[model samples]
Target: MTDSTHTIHPVWLRATHWLNALAVVTMTMSGWRIYNASPLFDFKFTKAITLGGWLGGAIQWHFAAMWLLAANGLVYLLCNVGTGRIVRKFFPLSPRAIVADLRAAFRGRLSHADLRQYNAVQRATYLFVIADAVLLVLSGLVLWKSVQFPLLRELLGGYEAARLVHFFAMATMVAFVAVHLAMAALVPRTLLAMIRGR
Candidate 1:
């Protein structure tokens, strides 16, 4: 967690992270197309196709991407269990270091130890993104079949509630990706590390 060093992200971590990114992007787009269908708004869940030729087809794509995301996410989580990367390098809760990082950022500089690594802000963003993805999966399930999963539906305050939460969370993630990309562009070397194993 200092400067003057570079520890490459393991290949498995890089692979799962990028694959998951693609899956999330595809799923969000296709899922939005599906939502344009019935929309479940106006106090109704009537069958309707809002953005595509068929709601069913959109559902298929959405489910496919969802599964892909799940697989990548699973691998990422499993790798974390034994890798110690989560605790040692990625958890993002080191208060003192975080404070220092903030100070450096305000001064338009990277903390000495974070020059070649994800800074505290980056670590915090990554953690939030991870948590948001988990929420997306859970909320999707809650909205998938409210009748079949009564307990989950109830926990999410019913299908409508779940749907709303899921949509908002998905939108939030989309926004995060937009911001993430801008940051990547600003710090090209950091992006290079992910793509070219720098």
Candidate 2:
């Protein structure tokens, strides 16, 4: 198919993508609020940008967003894998190619003409984010239901360890969001394609 006539992102892809984005953003903000109630580290996120009014409210929002994120992510994963899009679009990431792309990106020579196809670096980043999301969900499950999921909790090294893993995964996700926004700023057309599925 020609580029002009081709549809880059299908409706399901676009819908789930945005829904997942919304879920993650809300979950992250509310999670910050909840974290501030009893921090694990030295620092705490300010209340100004946090979601929900208080700790209980934040927990409610977090759980709501968690369900949304989990459901949307499951659909996205199943659809992508069933249609072979996962293999065709994201697999076979070569370390050499990723390194080359990273160099080009650093040198400000990367191209973003083909929104349908991802570069090596982009593919690697997406895969990493997906893995991180899975880790977050699993660790969260352990944190939420340690008593019911004793095996899972044990596998993740108990409640406290699971919480630590969850925190780091959240931090990684936030970093990914920052980089994703930067990339969107650099290539505005990519954002338009996502919005309109061009």
Candidate number with greatest lDDT: 2
Candidate 2, poorest ten consecutive residues by summed lDDT: 1-10
The best candidate in terms of TM-score? 2
lDDT of each: 0.76, 0.93
List model 1 lDDT by residue over 73-185, tens digit each.
98898898777778776764777877887788778786433434567777787788888899889889887776788888888888788888898788789899999888778
Clashing pairs in 1: 2-113, 3-112, 3-113, 36-50, 37-50
- What ranges in model 2 sit over 4 Å off? 1-5
- State TM-scores per candidate: 0.81, 0.96
lDDT of 2 at 9: 86
